[model samples]
Target: MTDTTGAGGPQDHESDGPTGPVIRDKRRIDPETGQVRDVSAEQVQETAAEQVAGGDNAFGGGVGDALPGGEQDPSGAPQATSGTPVDGGRSADDLHPDTVVAADRLEDLRRLQAEYVNYKRRVDRDRVRDREAGTTTVVEALLPVLDDLHMAKEHGELTEGPLLAIADKLETTLGRFGVERLGAVGETFDPAVHEALMHLPEADLPEGATETTIVQVMQPGFKVGDRVVRAARVAVADPA
Candidate 1:
């Protein structure tokens, strides 16, 4: 039997035997019509080769097309020039412009804060030291007056007219500034406030106890605000 199928026709081998070769041409389908037509394999291969070459060309030119003085975009897409702004309406440098200035201002503020803290501490320390020095000076000046009172008492003249009055006034004035005297006669002997220059034996007093009187107060001591400027020099009783 003679084969009837053509090389490039549809349904040409339908009437032939089941084992006969059927040649179906490749064709682009019309999406709206669903119709078929004849096309050569060489033509399909050539069109595929052209698409591959075009893809390579597109890949190679992509960056150049996006830049200035490069190929114009064939698809009419918008392109950026060298001077164009970025997405946020700002240039590259504007994004980080304030960083240095902000850092400098922070350094300045830190320096100023440190200086202020040091100044406050210095002023407070100076004020405390000055108050302590003033207290020391006042205590030093009152020692001579106390010596005079002792001298007058030894001579049995401390109770006379203006001298007693002056002594009372001086004590009252010094008392206002936290001055206090120690080592009085007949008071109990305390080592914390008294310095024993000599001990005298007394038969009437209890053993190891201070006797009736302080025989002598060589120098009077004064305290200011709970701080002793000098220790009193006095003679204490001795148990026989």
Candidate 2:
């Protein structure tokens, strides 16, 4: 037998037989690169491997550094020495298309729900504002008729007549709409609801009066809820 090996490993051997000398090449690891060489399929069949071996590392300097399994030995248990890439280096969700779609649906649903809530709030507010505005407009239009009725009532013209019934019915309807009159005589004078047409003599003020007081209402002011439609024209007397 003749040994014909290199510095890296035993490459081949030659032997003398009855016919002649037989030389067989049995190189395993490449002498130059120190990497394992590809064994013939016949040799692998003879060895009877249950799994295919992984390729050499094209990635980096980790031990068996293969592609998929990151956990194997040179005996080809499974290959990669580095960890498997999770979802193509993105996230685990990228691997799950259903999960990605579900997340997107959830976000859309949240946004739509928020938009609907805001729309509902705006519509409700606008509806209320429109209703109040319509009522206020109607009240303002009827103010002159109401003043005429009040004057007629003061002159005893509305004493048990069709005009009195009409006035009562109109006032009742306005009251149901939250309309109320302001600035009665002897009430405290307020600039918000009362317009002073004349300042009466302070001597006209009764005892214990502290602030300006309405002495006479020239025109009754009307309001709806907290909104003042018109201030009352009034005569005021200063406090004594």
- CA deviation > 4 Å runs, candidate 2: 1-95, 202-207
Cα lDDT tens digits for candidate 1, 1-240: 344345533443545533545455445786668876556788888777977777655546565665544534677554555445566875445556587689889999999999999999999988866775687698698688778887788788887899898988888887876778877766666677778787776424444554444656777777776578787888777544
Residue 187 C-alpha lDDT in model 1: 62
lDDT of 2 by residue, 35-146 (tens): 9998988876644442324322436445545535556666866643334455456534345788778999999999999999999999999987787788899999998898
Q: Candidate 1: lDDT over CA atoms?
A: 0.70
> In model 2, which residue pairs have backbone atoms overlapping below 3 Å?
70-80
**Candidate 2 backbone overlaps, count:** 1
Score each candidate by Cα lDDT: 0.70, 0.77
